[model samples]
Target chain A: MNLHHAPSSTPLVEMVDIEKHFGGIRAVNGVTLDLYPGEVVGVLGHNGAGKSCLMRILSGAMIPSKGQVRINGQDAQIHSPHDARDLGIETIYQTLALADHLDAPSNLFLGRELKTRFGSLDDGRMMREAVDVLKRLNPNFKNLSDPVSSLSGGQRQVIAIARAIYFDVKILIMDEPTAALGPSETAMVSKLIKQLRDDGIGILLVSHDMHDVFELCDRVVVMNKGKNVGSHRIEDVTKDDVLSLIIKGQLPDDWVPRSQETVQ
Target chain B: MAETDRSPPLVGWNLKLSASSFHKLSALFTLACLIIVFSFGNPAFFSINNGLTVLLQTAVIGLLGIGMTLVIITGGIDLSVGSVLALSGTVTGLCVKAGIPVAPSMAIGVCVGAACGLFNGFVITKMRITPFVATLGMMLIARGVALQLTGAAPISRLGEAFGVLGNGSLFRIIEKGANGFPKVVFPGIPYPVILLAIVAVAAAYLLNRRQIGRHIYATGSNEEAARLSGVAVDRTKMIAYTLSGALAGLSGNVLMSRLITAQPNEGVMYELDAIAAAVIGGASLMGGIGNISGTMIGAFIIGVLRNGLNMAGVSAFIQQILIGFIVILAVYIDQIRNRR
Candidate 1:
């Protein structure tokens, strides 16, 4: 079957006509958006506004009932989180999905562990890699062997991000990445996001923090009541505009909402 | 991060050692206390022959307990284990009676046990039956089948070679001895005890070193999380139950061989002992924590207590009451320790 191939200059990640329903409730209606390589796209929506559901679809945690996902111009069929990972999509869930009793290195290598020729896990290599990855992201981090339960919430979040990066993910989907972090840790995470973008990885950031979006994202998409409201370049839209679209389901008159508001 | 860097080497060592080492030490302490109490209560308990006797008696139950530990660790219980034991033993007996070789008969017994476990696994996983209810049903079915197979009578008179498994010693001793002054030649240990030790070691290694072992722990700890992380939760549970059943079957064969008869009612209430041994050994019913050494100690504790009660000439009925009290006390102590 011949599929539509986006031009070389097209965005690295694209969703078209995406729709999802949970019985009678439409969680995410028809929505379409594009994310370019080396760009962070902030998704803004109120609670139950379909931000998480959309992100879940992208992360392969949930499949859309209708629509298509394309990564690097190739059609991606992501039925499970592993499928999403195989397509170079990594998601750091808000819950973190961490094994509390396991140390950082073990948590980072939970399912897809590095093994020696003898087939046993290569702890030395895994620990070294975890240390290196953490150091690169936050030089202050030194406890690679500490169980995540002992770590602060920020540290656990960092380890989750490190896990995604170590797996060579090209697209990172973070759900409320800084929701529970202290101000300092939030700044640290913001810095890390910039560094990841500089390294040319695509990012879909779902957050309630408007400041974080304005500071880090290059573009922003607004969703309201299971429908895409509008997409705007970072410089072209204010936080007020995004907020209005999310809460009011309408953009300011001068900033007319896009006609393709309802997801297919 | 700072905790490890600035902590004194001795303090760090103590902290690290305390977490894992304390559990081992506690188990050993209990074991030592049992040995002392038993030997003090009965002079015969200190004899090597008595030790061999205790080990032989505990072997089948101990083996069943090992598998039960794994199942219990996964937050699941197998009430059907005793029934599976009877069923497998009957199958082995029937096969042997039909002129099947000893090895193949044993294999069939183990296979039958494994099949029963698979059924339990399937019912729980696919049919969404709770482990307790499903295994309870299985218990009745297995026990009924066992009774039906033997026509409600015990099957006896197995080959002498089979009898050697339970009744015969690895080495024979020729001795001329009286109670006060006696010269007794040494006899080798029972092969069953050696077999039990080997099985225990193998179980320890599997639970500690293998990926399959980790999967079992993970499935027990947080099954949804484990499944989300790509661990095959259903398959792991299936393996746990299957292994538990198969081991119970093996234990049954040993029990039958020792008794030289297939007693359908012999294993009644055995699942309770196996579960109690597992729990007392630190295999939490909540799942995600256990060790072979702990279970072995638990088995020894049970064995020694029984021996001590017998030597003390305690009534059989009172022995049961004491055992029940001991099980409760052990569990109560464990809960207190866990809280601390």
Candidate 2:
């Protein structure tokens, strides 16, 4: 992905020293991360590397055992997904978070549905808007009224992405957005991520795929064993460099994050 | 933005008919076949008198099926419906016998049913009990209460007005016959049949056009997903079980009126009939699918089969066996359809 980053923008979101423990086990520890407008920041980690744990805290699906999450430079309490959405943070989960029996419009507006003047379900309006949003991502998609169960993995992912974008997403968190897509579908999703980045939306992409991280991200955040190793600009870091950070939990000695450059 | 090295997405449209639609249509076909076979077997089965008789018989079970449809659509079941029915009807009968006004007594009966539903909802939602277990407990509790309410005796000699609700007919006409004797035609529609129609219309409207309807379907389809999506999962589930209780109450009242007495055993095993009717109507036990029209048709099919079999001198025992087999078949077909 050829991502053009606009320098020195306000932080759209920041999680400071987030810590989470499930029973006696530490799932995430002292992980701090942030996003700025018009940037696709890849959150890279191997399986069970606290990648999802950290994102869950930001998504309001789980409360951190300790730490603070701030949106737009203000402290935010994300007690639930509703709270996260209210903060303009939308999470398109890896599993898609869709009811298989429900159609696209229903899933897109599952929690917040459009209503007619007299208060009936404004399905027609929801469908039209869903078609519009879906067309932008995958114009060839046609099964607007069919349930997600009838859809292929690629189509379901597109629907999930449509749901996040339908809302005014300021900080989009996509967990493995192209895990189920074919080569062509992956390209479509790769391009969609770029389009969202161009739209001035800050995205936190959680991916284990190196190609996805290198192609779609402007900046990369690596995590290993419940801790953030480091963040680096894609141009300044190689795939092997990020891989070493993911595997060894240490950054290259000469490399410095832009945030750290000012302090030193 | 990076350009992808692939052809543009191939946009195409195909209107594929869903499997659920096919199953529901198949239900209609079954009902048609039942009608044809019965008509050929018994000449009386095709008569208007028998038709009304079948419709009247269907009314109580049909009402119960309406509530069952809602509950089943939300992926819940109410096993206490039969017990609740008896209790509601007995309460109404006792009230009427005590010289309370008929209208208020009947209203109280319906309220009793709704209250039982609310209690079931409370147990299932607040107590965090599985709906099947909660309702199963309620079913036994309700049966004991019903038995205690009457000491296993029937509440008899209910008020004239109260009996009319179950036994009375609406829109009757009286005319002078050829012998100049006053001849009175049975009411144009049995009161229960008319009541069933009113309730069915209301239930249909709620299921098809309301926000609550969609929420119920969503909650039933995938509860965790619904909760994450911000649907009030608890409230939607409660409403379904509560509605089931209320409908069972209405059925009990109708049964009491028709029998001209409230017996503790009035609706013994009636839950099976209500559930069977809903299933035959195309409701999925797994939830997220059903329609009132289909349920109505389903109820009629059951009613006609029972009455037709009885008229043909098929013993009641044999009738029960046949109905049980049919219910099994319906559910099996539903499972097969869902598998595909």
Best by lDDT: 2
Alpha-carbon lDDT of model 1? 0.80
Off by over 4 Å in 2: A1-10, A252-264, B1-17, B97-99, B179-182, B335-340
Model 2: per-residue Cα lDDT over B1-340, one tens digit each: 0001111223362434456556667887988898899899989889877888898999999999999989988888888899999989888888888889888887888888888898999988899998789888888888888889889899887757778888888777778899999787654688899999999998887765577877887887888777767678888888888888888888898999898898888888888898999888878788777778878878887998899898889999999999999989988988887787
Best by TM-score: 2
Binned by DockQ into CAPRI classes (incorrect, acceptable, medium, high), candidate 2 is acceptable
Chain A TM-score per model, please list them.
0.91, 0.91
Clashing pairs in 2: A1-A215, A140-B11
TM-score of 1: 0.88
TM-score of each: 0.88, 0.90
State the lDDT of candidate 2 residue by residue for A1-264, as single tens digits.
222444455588888999999998889989888888888999988788899999988888888999998888899999888889988899989888888777888888887888889887777788789989998888898777777778888888988888898888899999988888899999988888898899989999998898888888889998999998887788767787898899888866776554456668
How much is the lDDT of residue A224 in candidate 2? 91
DockQ score of candidate 2? 0.35
Which stretches in model 1 have alpha-carbon errors above 4 Å? Answer: A1-7, A134-147, A256-264, B1-20, B168-184, B338-340
| Model 2 / residue A166 / CA error / Å | 1.3
